[model samples]
Target: MLPLLVVSALAAVQSLAYEQTLGFNSAPIVETRSLDEIYHAALAEGGVVTFWLGGDEKGDEDAIKKEFEGKFPGMTLNLTTDLSKYHNGRFDEQLAAGHVYVDSIAFQTVHDFPRWEEQGALLHYAPVGFDKIYPPMRDVRAAYYGILTVGWAGKWNTDKLPGIAAPIEWEDWLRPEFKDKLVLTYPNDDDAVLYAFDLIMQQYGKSWFERLLKQNPRWVRGTRTPDTVMQASNSSWAASFTSDGLFPTSNINVSHPVQGSFVTWFQLAAIPKDAPHPEGAKLLHNFMLTKEWQATRGSWPVRSDVEPPTGYPAIFEMPGTNITYFREWMSDRAKLERLRTWFEDKLGSAQGLSPLIDGI
Candidate 1:
């Protein structure tokens, strides 16, 4: 049996305990200001906002900076991008020091938001489009909301394997021809990637993991590296999932497997109660929900009114996918850490620079 003890405690966010937790207020403080009004208020409060964004690459901050600044002139955004695992610890440390420097946070560590809310650390203000957001994607109290929805899927390079099948299944990569041709992000390093591996293991068991280890897949840090390696034609397949999606002209294709579940989760964002520039933080949160921003995220938007990326259905509407389960999985940190350690023991420690340093 697959460690029933380890997975037994999985709980959904909408469960009564979460919705009615003791000492944690679930009442929302909805924001009534228009984006223009919020922007002007931000300008009066030093016109600067700093967000500790979660990502592997420093370069990921560029586009967001351009967009946020262009939309609200005179307002400056100091956005820092790093792994959420590290960012969460830093956030906690800052709180312990009684100085929360960052104005906002968009992180993948879904569990932290609730803990912060209970500690009375997060601002209870909702963004302008809070009502329009898919209910499950927003915190009941509106201390945080999912800003973007991202999914992970198997990816392979058609150019490298000319006769390869389309929409390759997770098991397909284990074939003899694929030996040493697969690249994967370490499950220990990224929660989304970790959840993807956990799903596969649940379906296929430890025997499957043994077979995979025999294949000698190259492991790296960060979810972006596998796709980057495949794009450069350095690897022909990725048995592990990649967050990148399909493009019309690209030879690389993302697999939405019919035989197994793929993982998707919302990237949650919130403003801190102790933000140095509270007005600017609120402005940035509201800006994220704006149609201009939501439509261009290249992933599913939390708001129902926005159109999804071209040629794809909304993530929740997609078949062979799990959103709620991933949320449950992320909420249980102990289970995640246990599984992460188990995978590391089997796959050996991850080797290589982060995609950020590798210039992906």
Candidate 2:
């Protein structure tokens, strides 16, 4: 619906034209084509509909691919991780050639859509159910929508940071007592954490960061790092980054307004302009935004018609939840890159990383 009609072209393959058929009533039927028919046309016409997915959810990718192939026979899905590391070059090389090899791309970098569109690397392809998309999501040009909205929050030992003055605000992280006792998630590898760090720097400035850096943070490469550190009570304070998780049910406390710290949206998806099988891509996109598929994907549903995933209360946009709006951070890529550099220069070491309790 965003008309993410990104206008980019591909070289490895040729485009296939197929008759489209909507399962709609009151509409004159010209030619309605199922996803299978379109896919077959792509294969028959000498093009492979490649679906590229990025993230840790390999299982979800498998399921999505499975469902897609089930619906559209002969289609192929190619999944990969570490997208952020090479996303810029990966697409740039393909796009600059004036003949790209890849078609649709899915990543957690919500900002990439606008940037790519600006670069004229995206294609516009309106999916089947554009009107049903939520307003916030509709504003974006990319047709692909992320099934799960992510949030940047914190996890810590309540027993350690006890009292009304919870370590909710970024300022709390700099408390003299809390310093030298914190272990946050990795930032360089995970932009979601980097986005949250950007908020801390934006709100508090260098002095605050300098002080927090003194406390030391473990720069481990894992989303579960915070959970691992907090669950063991290794650090009295820690940074929790999660797109999907339950804090209440778990023993560790994840502060969402118990004090401060804003939760920001982390990622989104978009359909490609030169889709070998645009029909299948659109169908899969529609299916993902639907309640039925979200339940299986294990993330917040974008549709108001769908209930939040069981046991979940709200998303990054909900009221009382102060979100930094990761979209804002996308503006200054250099600054983010520098922030990552600063984190490494200041706190990515044994001496800089907070150690577990001495006895333990």
Per-candidate TM equals 0.88, 0.66
lDDT score, candidate 1: 0.78
Which 10 consecutive positions of candidate 1 have the poorest summed lDDT? 9-18
Minimal lDDT window, size 10, model 2 = 12-21
For model 1, the stretches where C-alpha displacement exceeds 4 angstroms are 1-27, 233-240, 246-249, 358-360
Global lDDT scores for all candidate models: 0.78, 0.53
- Per-residue lDDT of candidate 1, residues 14-91 (tens digit): 221233356556577788888899889999999999988888878766899998999899999998999898899999
lDDT of 2 at 264: 49
Tens-place lDDT per residue, model 2, 19-73, is 2223122122122455445556555654344556655433434676667666656
Point to the candidate with the largest lDDT.
1
Off by over 4 Å in 2: 1-49, 56-63, 66-76, 118-120, 139-147, 156-181, 204-211, 222-225, 228-253, 295-297, 309-317, 320-324, 348-360
User: Judged by TM-score, which candidate is best?
Assistant: 1
Clashing residue pairs, backbone N/CA/C < 3 A, model 1: none
